[model samples]
Target: MAFGKWVKQCFESVVDPDKENEVAELTQLLQAGIKERKRSFVLAEVLQDRVYKQRHLDQARNGIYQRYLARAWADGRVQESELEILSWVSKCLDIPPQTLRAINLETARPKFAEALAKAMDDGIISDLEAAELTEIARAGGLSLPNFVEKFFHIEGEQFLRGIFAAAIADDHSAVDVLEQLVATAAKLGLSRKVVVEAIRPQAVQYIEHVLADAKEDDILTSQEESTIRQLIETFELPIAVQVYIDEELRELRLLTDIKNGKLPSIAAPPGVNLKAGELMHYHGDAVWQFLRLLKSGPDITEHPGVLAITDSRLIFRSLTRSGAFGFGTIVAHDSSRGVIEVQRQAKPVQRFICHDQSRIPAAIFLSALRMANQTLTSQDDKRRSRHIPRDIRQRVWQRYSGRCAECNAGEYLEFDHIVPVAKGGSNSDVNVQLLCRNCNLKKSDKI
Candidate 1:
């Protein structure tokens, strides 16, 4: 057949209402590859052939039914009349109920999207709108929760998270508003798990900010405690967050106690003998290195070990080495780079470094060392001698402009020894400088 003749026949078959060959017309419609929307009406018309059913018509059946569903839902609603017509069409075409349901669901997705977009326009889905959403999903052959999980749950979760962030960012007292938002999210079919996960990050961030503010002075005052307790009651914070809070509070108390000269003591580890009066102030994993000047160059031999600091001595034990050194044998100590470096009289300078999770920070280690050394120095005598001569205090205070040398803070200022007196530093003008309490506490006894 000529191309023109075949094309002419195809048009006649489609236009004729009482066409003799319904199958041929339908075949031509499918073969011509016309867009589904344009050919769907004619396809539905021919599918009314009661005697022409075939397994080959299944694909065309699905397409035509999808078009029926899409048109019925075009106005974002499926009326009772449209539902009756759809049922008639499905029965005429012998489409399975499950297949019809699948087609409707696929067709209804866009309608759901449109409705959701409008409902979310103001960043809220009110109770009435939420009800409409449930009805839409159900009418479209989907459960509201399942549909949300498959399509809009992530977006819904993000929307709730944004509300949480904005609420907390605006003011901490917005807890009541946050509670309402959470309830609204729940009503919109978002799961409790999703809601909680959405709020967790923002809540944790707020808690951290509050903790930082409370510990700003290295002390948790009674008022700060009250505020923290209020937050806990307000949020009903999760155990993980509570654990972090407890750990931070414990560390703050420990630091405050250290600052007040109440050093913590630990029992000696196995195989390590303690002197009669020696008290263990600190113990942790450490890498001890002995410095050397070799023919090739300067070298260090590292002995990985456990190091203990005591009132009278430093003890180190390792698989390959073990030793103890009296405090009197120490020449100087420096912790400038997170490592404790000790210069010993007539012995190689040793470096103690730690890199584990429980590793001691250099500043804290120095604080412990200073507190430990106080046991050897008369605690009362050191306190009395800490008083600087008036002229020396005047010269040091003027040199730093009456501000902390370390942080430039002028409040709660105290005269600090650059080289601690226990380390043989005197109350000389050069050795004294003004440091705020916080910085001085952090500096401790490092020389």
Candidate 2:
């Protein structure tokens, strides 16, 4: 059955003729009966509540906890990486923090102890073995703690190979290794000196691969630029990040002037009507994929734009190139098991992970989004531009070539408020940059 029809039926119960007439007459008396009935038929809330149950939440915790222990014990002992995941899971889940902490010490006893016994038949964690163990820890969702971030890369190359192994081959034949290399550098907080040294030895392939990847994507992401500058000095690249800018950023590079205060403000996708200052909220780096955004209805397929968080809604900005996907926003939240569920009628619930300090509480953001979305029909629409204009959008976009500010991806380029509107920042160009759908979603609005 069609989703909209099925949804309509879910809210409808078979009523006797007398009951139906009575409901109709009562609504007529109030004069807003139909409106009231529509509100009660909301499908987002009903489906969200049913999709996740207490059992599912508890099971999810148990599962991750077990996987955490296995990865921790892989090294014959729980190390910092495993310890950090426990800490993150603590903050993410509703369980007592102590329970999660205790797992660190406990993982060693049963699993590590047994593994030690089995390994005794041979030997101990050799560098190769320890390196492999590290790789396993990374694969099993290691959330490296700050203290461990840089120091953890002390065994940089080896550990990097371990990480790369999980994602792709560790072969040194080409620069396509650029993707894995940058990802590892960012994750382990590899020092610039270390990062340069590592790439220098592999420069032939690294440079070749970087150029290839750049051409493939057509631009370097802000994150990619940051990584590149770490390798070479700023104002040093002649070819430009894209437009060949030599100044700190594009305006200087293009030698083009920026109309300081004339930058564009937070934009709503086509078909969306925005009340000035209605969009405000913070977010962080997060992983995202093309979700159909609907489950029950005839598959709505994929939408062409990216989604954003405003003070009162989850906004969808469709792509400008092609793709007829629709766009708009809705808001709400529930953090039952490290995930926030956003209820949207006919749209599959949007789930975001909040397992790291880099992530803001979904509930907090959702509440603000809900209140902001309500402004569409409320006195809130009269709000003046509470957000200021930095007028730096064009400058930043030029820096990255209309790609995601982080990954430099071309599709779903979106404007992200550097400091979220909810955090009391402006909707101006200076406070925003163009981010690809994926990077914008992964970045923390708070961080």
Candidate 3:
């Protein structure tokens, strides 16, 4: 037979006739009775002792007696209706109505009436149901308030339904709904912990909905999806954490190129100036080192050159190698001070070298050197009294469009020594100039 049929048969066979009759009556009352009416009837039945007495019945009665007694004592009078109800219950139950009245003379007041009213409103419970519950409570030696609290605690279907409603209304994002549910439970004076525990499955369902929506919407790219899935599998992180990891990874990749050799290198453009006789420098030691290290290993052959410059600070591109770039600066001077400084001053401020030597034509370097010399000559003119070379000055004048090369404010300009006479430049036209006073001062011998 089916499970329900089997259960019904077992119950019918095991339960005594009196108990079965009581159950049948309760079922009928529960099926038809309104909340408050049923609760009143249940309370009447409890007082009448329709249910069997247990060792804990006296303890349970003590609480009910105290509550009613306190109210009677406070009013300095007992309502005749309440007294009649108490009397009827006492006579039927074989308890002393006089004893209850005596207690009321000292203390009595309802403590959980409001809670009982609410429980009645929720369909999971009713007055007749509470009467049945009271039987169990009395048998367990629990007061009415304590019994009601425990009953609500163990039955959380209503709480779960509320959580489900909130979750559905909020696009099925469980965290948001759960937070509201927690606050609501607290405000309603429900057991927050028990409610939360009961609603956990519903919350999980909502979380699944959120994740499903995200996936269906393609909010995460293929790579992001893969990464998130991996994180979820490996770490078993919550959905929120998985989303966070995906976002973080995406941001990092946006700021960097991860594919090997994919990043372009900085190149010295044609005709740019370089200081002649000054040793030229190239910064690519990190790339080279990475290449060597990766080549030495068995896993890979090449790595991408990851290098960039920001605010004059050189940033090396990340590589799968073991070491960072080395910096070396070269200087050229008269034999007396011919020295080069080789030290790691952080990293290159800018990357100007190509990894593929074949791509760097010789003409590019030559042009760069010429540009560098022009820059140096311009500097020399400012620091000495000797005139700049006519050829150099002509170029300078042309560069400044025949205006004063120094201030760019005066026409009919002169060539002034960028280096002073004491610094040993010639006094000839090569070292002299026709200049406006502002240009002369502004272009004082200082490079």
In model 2, the runs with Cα more than 4 Å from the true position are 1-230, 234-264, 267-271, 280-309, 315-447
TM-score of each: 0.46, 0.19, 0.25
Assess the local accuracy of residue 30 in candidate 3 as a C-alpha lDDT between 0 and 100: 32
Give one digit per residue, the lDDT tens place, for model 1 in 364-429. Answer: 555656655655344335434645675676567568855678998644465677887657889889
Between prediction 2 and prediction 3, the one with superior lDDT is: 2
- Pairs that collide, model 1: none
Off by over 4 Å in 3: 1-145, 165-176, 187-189, 220-447
Candidate 3: global Cα-lDDT?
A: 0.39
* 285-404: candidate 3 lDDT, tens digit per residue: 324221122445633133345333211223344445323221212121110001111123342222223442311211222223324344444323432333244355434434444344
The lDDT for every candidate, in the order shown, is 0.67, 0.42, 0.39
Worst 10 residues of 3 by lDDT: 332-341
Query: Model 3 — TM-score against the truth?
Result: 0.25
Model 1 misplaced regions, further than 4 Å: 1-56, 172-174, 217-241, 250-447
For residues 1-447, could you state the per-residue lDDT of candidate 2 as single tens digits? Answer: 999988765565353334445434433332232235433433233234333334334445545555646765665555666667555544434445565545543443344234323422232234444344344344333433232342344445554444433322233423344444554454444554455455443342233233324322234455544444543442122344423222223321111111111222355555555556665343333333233534574332333344444554544444442211212333323332124444445656555543332113343343454343444432223122332222354455455655666776654454566776545667665676766545665665323
State candidate 2's TM-score.
0.19
